[model samples]
Target: MSERVDLWNNGNLVQDIFLGEIKVPVKVLRNDSFQAWYLLQPRENGNKSSKTDDLGSLRLNICYTEDCVLPSEYYTSLRNLLLKSSDVQPISASAAYILSEVCRDKYDAVLPLVRLLLHHQKLVPFVAAVAELDLKDTQEANTIFRGNSLATRCVDEMMKIVGKHYLKVTLKPVIDEICESPKPCEIDPIKLKEGDNVEINMENLRYYVDKVFREIVRSSISCPTLMCDVFYSLRHLAAKRFPNDPHVQYSAVSSFVFLRFFAVAVVSPHTFHLRPHHPDAQTSRTLTLISKAIQTLGSWGSLNKTKLSSFKETFMCEFFKTFQEDTFTESVKKFLDDVSSTESKEPSGVSEPVHLKEGEMYKRAQGRTRIGKKNFKKRWFCLTSREFTYHKQQDKEPIFTIPIKNILAVEKLDESSFNKKNMFQVLHGEKPLYIQANNCVEASEWIEALCRVTRCNQKRLSFYHPSAFLNGNWLCCKATAESTEGCARCTADVPADTQIEIDGDRETERIYSLFTINRSKLQKLEEACGSIAVYQGPRKEPDDYSNFTIEDSVATFHTLQQIIDIVEKLNESHEKYQKKRSSSAKYGSEENPIVGKVS
Candidate 1:
């Protein structure tokens, strides 16, 4: 008889028993319907005694067929039999149920067995059972499977049972615990040392380095230095470890921590002014780490030749803006200026330094202009009663002033012409007021006469700048108030009622005329004729005051001549008038000779 392995229910009956021939290999198949094992003879035919020596006898596998339907009582009996086995055995009853359910494609039964294993503190076995068999409805079942309800649960239980913790902390908490634990087994750092003998116990070094590296890097922030060391360790320990495990490889690839730390320590501070002196220290440390990582990665002999290339590419790309904008360009300019000025270093033949315009560099206090440029002065002006005075750009305090003399003749330009050049050239083209004074005597008389006609300032004598001639020339004159012996025929066609400008450049000028035409008499004459129909015909022949129906050139001419006579009288006898005014209580005396003919 061969040795028999029997598993029984609490009812003292064999639920599943294994028996084979002592001399020959015997195959066994369990019949679920009978809850008994059936011996299926092996392929080799030999005497029973020789079966004991057959190597195939020890390699037995139990199989169940699809058509063999087991009673529910038999499944229950099998479960009780496994549970009744000795406690020292690591065999799982839940695993048995899970296996049977999987072979039968019973997902509903498998989920319950998963729950039973979760209850028995066998989380790894339960997870293994779930992983070993493909359940049609695994996702639906896992929704209800919370992890073990304790903080100190094993890594296997904590990872699966409380998947929420991993999701919440992003697995950082677990990685931190693995690193921070005092136990040597928690994280074996020796395997990650740079100079471990790799050929002897090669598997142990690779295994320990990979295992420690995996847990360390799952969350890098908790143990950044350790993360760097493990990667360096792997680089030295085995060529096989590079490239494929980038999660570990990238973390181990030296520069990873330096890049991340640089972003926070250097980049964040310079951009946001986040940290003080501490950030400076961190920056130095980061640069050192980065250099080491680059050197180490460059020395590697593996497919991750691209890893070294990619590290450089990624570092350059990630920090390009910071290095170029914030650090390299600005600092280089500062350093060049400092060295060139202080040390008196001669320029190299390679390249000359370029200068910057104002408001270019950030270092010289925000919103300020840079070192060198000329300061521009504001233009200044002053106004006088007779004229406007402005400093010429070439002249200093003593300004070259301009006076708006008598407005030659005020005239408005056509609206079309005014719109085209905006009246800027109007002053340069034609003088506004035009007039002539007899001598010094006639000039004073006419000045008063103009006050009556225009009703403007009584004493001021000036025209808007550049519009009137300071020298009182005929061509500069716009129109005439009275005739002057020197230039009597000078005449200009001036439009009426155009506005004049007087500011900074010009003073307000009091207008004085040598003659005044009575508006009422002119209106009466136009009314008698139906129209002052000058320029009525298609050819637009010239018309004069003589064309009126009244037909009194003498009356028209006399009216104008009387006004002129009054001005002349005043001009000729100003001293007499002045003397009489000094003597009289009233200005227009009854005996005043010039007053009687004027009215």
Candidate 2:
């Protein structure tokens, strides 16, 4: 009798008949075929009632015919399947072999797959597969690694594998890109000459270096080999770029120091799992690099000797002591504490208010503003009770001062067609000073503070003509808003109005009278009123001054009289209390003669 066996035909089960116990081999007619061969044995009980015990299945060679190549999409599908399986199941050797073959034979076809694997954080498996092949040692691999964005994505992985070789290949290119980019320093390189001021582009360089080091830090968390490689690469490149020029070298080192790489490492030791024995060599190597960087700074001539000396005396000395003890966290913390303490001890701005007069109060605010159409320059402005002075740097003399009393108005400006924001105009007589804040909120705060101290309310000044004093055009002259046209109606030509002058003087006197009260007397009167309020006890309600007429002189006079009465009552009570205390002391001494003996 013949029995039928099942076989997969186009992924569907189909039956094949065998005439005898001897098996017949089947031939695949298609160019590509999938074959699964298996052996079946009788059950242990030896019952041959059509059921058999299956041992295991074997995946036979699934080969494509000559002139037929596997579709590129098939490789992609296989790669994705392998990556998906890597999450839950270990990828079989057969699957890894297929991927390695694809990568080696059709490298371009598998590049996208490799990138996808890297992006999905399946780098370990991908690298394992690549390791099985000759890809790493190939010229094509290096070209692909260097030419594409994959370098950045897999920099850490590559570093773990290639170490300094990867850094050596990539560092120069990054530095070159940074050097060629638009820098914060506005130096024209073509016109630059010897002895001319050559700004180091510190900001742009810092940004570039920060990005590189951040990637290095992220990679170092998993691969400790990156720590030494990255630092060595940076130090080597810096030396190569600046050779014997300590000034440029100092700038490069300063930029790196500003990144606070060591501080970040110390603060996030857990992230890197940076233990002495865990990553034995890397731990010592990282500390050595940090120490070397700091020591290099001490030897730089570009840094201010006085400031550097102070830093050495404080941060460097403490850092080295703790660093030697392997207390990295404490070392960083102490260094930061010393830095903060030193900064806090200094004046808030570039310079102290060196010329502040007695009884005058001042506040320092730091901001940048355009001066006479040039680029915006940072300035430290000191606003006093009566004047505003600005300095270029700390310890420098004031470059300009404007009397706050002379300020006619301060108006917030709207963003124009350009994307400019947080701008305001300060008007003094007929001249306008345009200033800008970092943001709208900062501008609003400055406006509020200036109005309060200068006593020039924006609301009251809003009624004045918008262009009254713009570009030196005066309202008194009835000149055109454009100063170029000149004043057509000069006040000097007209006869003096005696009545107007008298009215102005009387108004000024009235305003001055509001501030003429002695502040010390007012303080005493306030204390007296507070005492009276306490002595009266909690009443049903207190008098509401909300409805009081602001312009009523009679009402003001009555309020002043009430305050005087309260002060007089408080003085009388104080005098009586003093007399009572003296009498009590005398009576106590007479009553207790033994107390005086003890004393």
Candidate 3:
């Protein structure tokens, strides 16, 4: 239940001339007309739209007509009184009060209401009062008055008009204080102190590290440049905390790589830095730390395979890319080679292949593996002619018979040609699988050939228009038929009954099937002329059968039957001659039978 009462602002109810000096209290009938008086009504507790309340009584009661004038004259006097109140009087104060009370809990409405009051010059003082009340509790502003565009605008406008003196002087000062705190800076490594200190903030380390890591994850930092700093940091932290513990060293390195990878590659791009770094004295200390981290990682055996595998999965590309440079590549190769050399004597399946140095190529020859693993050898390739060439170490001669599937796509190399120093990248959609190429052109050609041989075998794609094929474009698709050297029409032979209609201007020819009866004939013509390599000459038209149709009279007569009988006889004669020739080739020497065709 609710009620609304409209009260005019001017004077008291009893003594004012508007009501002609009426008494304070009086009762009136529930349904009285008021044509000659200033009618007043009391607030009630029921829906105004309802004719009667649940108790079967009218909700509102009015005073009857009396010796009274309208209240408009009193309202005019009230305005004059407001004008005389102060330099900035509270005119329309009642309306402003009602608006504030209604919107007290809904803070977003305060701005619009204040703006509305701004248009009315008499209500400035009332509006200023509301603003002062709001600014009294800063916490309330935070809780209820959200800082959106409108709120900001309202605050700015209020401050401009009312000045800071009318409100809390500390509000603007506190906001400035917040803006003064330093934001995170670019390229500044987090200041990590060595020992656990009494008063240092633990969250600052995490906050700054996370900020830096996010940049790394997003590739804001290049792998080559940041790997040293990131890996060195891990090693330093481990050495400082765990001293000589080998397990701790390995765990630290692995976790460090994962965190850096997530930050630099998986986080926001702009937050990271990928600027190039030349090998210089400035970053010597960081580079030394990275080498130590690698050495720590190398000390692990089978016990740490799980964590090491995760590290490998996440940063294998980063590792490989780092390994390609001169300073890091040799060290990585030596480490892997050392590992391989140690496992050679022991019966540990087959040793992992040593990562060879760039510019060096290894060809696999035929050989059987020592029995411990199911697959004696997993296949790999050597970079040759920009693309990779497969070689099984056991094979005497190279054979390009094995099929490689699941190719993601060919990657362009940075260098101009397939040489010793070109860059290449081929992602296989798997985390740890990639093929490097020497150059782009060879990659393109190789990938095209690979697709041709290894396209999905179960389904066939429909023929695509020749215009759709661009010189270097490639994609996976379902083909309906396989034809390597010719158009789809030549590959899928039409039957003898199908007719081919050729259409085009004088310079070109377009071929299409007209009827089933002439297809075989057209196919024979194509085969005889070698399919007109470019259809260079003017287009030729076949004899038109536009008006050819069997007449109904001829079809009902005996002459039609005679024509069909003769055609059947001629077909039988050809069949017999073919059989006789085949029998002669099978039984006698290579010779044709029924030379005269009498049989």
Per-residue C-alpha lDDT of model 2 across residues 1-599, encoded as one tens digit per residue? 32224232222232222111212244442326656564643223232434343433334555643221122332343344445533321222222222322232333223433344433445444443332222223343112212222222233333333233323232334333433343442123443346544335323333543444443322221112222223333333444444564343233222322233333333223223332111112232233334343333323232333434455334333333322322322332222222222111111221333233211112212222222333345666666545766667655777777775566555554444113477655655544555667767666655554543343212223223322332334433555454343322211110121001222222222212221223343333334444444455665665432222122333333344443344344345445655665666655563222333444
All-Cα superposition RMSD per candidate: 51.6, 38.1, 40.5
Candidate 3 lDDT, 227-301, residue by residue in tens: 222233333444445455544433433432332223222121112221111112212222223333333333333
Best by TM-score: 2
lDDT of each: 0.28, 0.35, 0.29
Backbone clashes in each candidate structure, one number apiece? Answer: 21, 2, 38
User: Which window of ten consecutive residues has the lowest lDDT sum in model 1?
Assistant: 505-514
User: Which candidate order results from sorting by TM-score in descending order?
Assistant: 2, 3, 1
Task: Give candidate 3's error at residue 229 in angstroms.
Answer: 9.2
- Model 1 CA lDDT for position 159: 23
Report the Cα lDDT for candidate 3. 0.29
* lDDT for each residue of candidate 1 in 252-366, tens digit (9 for 90 to 100): 2322222222222222332222222112222333323333332332221322324334444453333222222232223222322221121111122213322111111101111
